[model samples]
Target chain A: MSKQFDNVSVVAKANVYFDGAVTSRTVLFADGSKKTLGIMMPGEYEFGTDSKEIMEIQSGELRVLLPGETEWKEIVGEGEFTVPANSKFKLEVRKVTDYICSYLP
Target chain B: MSKQFDNVSVVAKANVYFDGAVTSRTVLFADGSKKTLGIMMPGEYEFGTDSKEIMEIQSGELRVLLPGETEWKEIVGEGEFTVPANSKFKLEVRKVTDYICSYLP
Candidate 1:
């Protein structure tokens, strides 16, 4: 799938796939550029961020880990949630899952 | 939860929420506009399109319905699939599901 942004330039696009395992990738983008990331999986995964941000889980199950928090919280299915930037957090994926994540500067 | 496209304009954005049943929405976009849709769900959902298009299921389980085909084919999580534009199709949502769907013109 492809998307074009007339209002903002796309810094990066990725297809993340996991099969009941943990996978992590360090993301780097151009300064002042908004980044959109999508992860498609059939299991569970976790996402961590170092900055304040917004996260949308487009499918499956996800858990959010907050800074200084040892355990994760269930955000339920659908809807939207916010992660404070520069704060470390993790996205745990449960069951077979997929995600489309975008970041705006 | 929000995205800005500098190379294209957003024609519409909607938040789709589902809890285990089938849910669908008819989409209309401006001419020459590219639409980006995201479905954030926890179970399974199916999506159909009339024109030949690309679909990315960001998580969970999804089945694809082909024209003249009575049964749906399982498209595993965390990848992309295509549907021919102008063709009628259905999105069968299974389990506790959510989806983010976008159309580009």
Candidate 2:
């Protein structure tokens, strides 16, 4: 929602996955909360979550198959979705997607 | 280099270049300095710098050709290079590269 996050710590190293098709920078907050700002290249990806995740898509087009959902949800530009903990979801990303994923315990 | 940068601001959006093959998150410091923590997927890329740039390679295999250079310099794992302002450089990346680029005024 905000343009930038202030007074935080960012890890220099990125969390690279899918052979660099997906990459994120870890940002730590003062409240001990952790978030990842990431980029996902256009591809199909399935991800499992350890904690509840709130994914805010900043730009791009994509279809998501959330856990326990039979139908795929489409987001053309900006959107948000929540995934349950210990759940798996599928994404058919059609464009370069920029997202912020917030982890909740 | 430090493992992390503390007490900083991070832009939520990513700067995507070369059709998302190169993407970076902008990190802002208190002293008006700027840096970009970025990843480059295996490919060839040419970039021009507006200000002097100090590129620290955290990990990767790549060859760089700075402006006015005839030979391509190789970096196997970790290395550092500087490009003068308004200069162009070429990169032949063999592996996914994680780098921190500091922009100096």
TM-scores of the models, in the order given:
0.40, 0.97
**lDDT tens digits, residues B1-105, model 1?**
232233433221222334312222222333553434443333444455744666655555667676678988775555565667777665654422223345644
**DockQ of candidate 2?**
0.78
What is candidate 1's TM-score for chain A? 0.53
Give the number of colliding residue pairs in candidate 1.
54
Q: What are the Cα lDDT values of the candidates? A: 0.45, 0.96
TM-score of chain A of each: 0.53, 0.97
lDDT of 2 by residue, B1-105 (tens): 559999999999999999899999999999999999999999999999999999999998999999999999999889999999999999999999999999999
| lDDT tens readout by residue for model 2, A16-62 | 99999999999999999999999999999999999999999999889
lDDT of 1 at A70: 79
lDDT (Cα, 0-100) at A38 in candidate 2: 96
RMSD of each: 8.9, 1.6
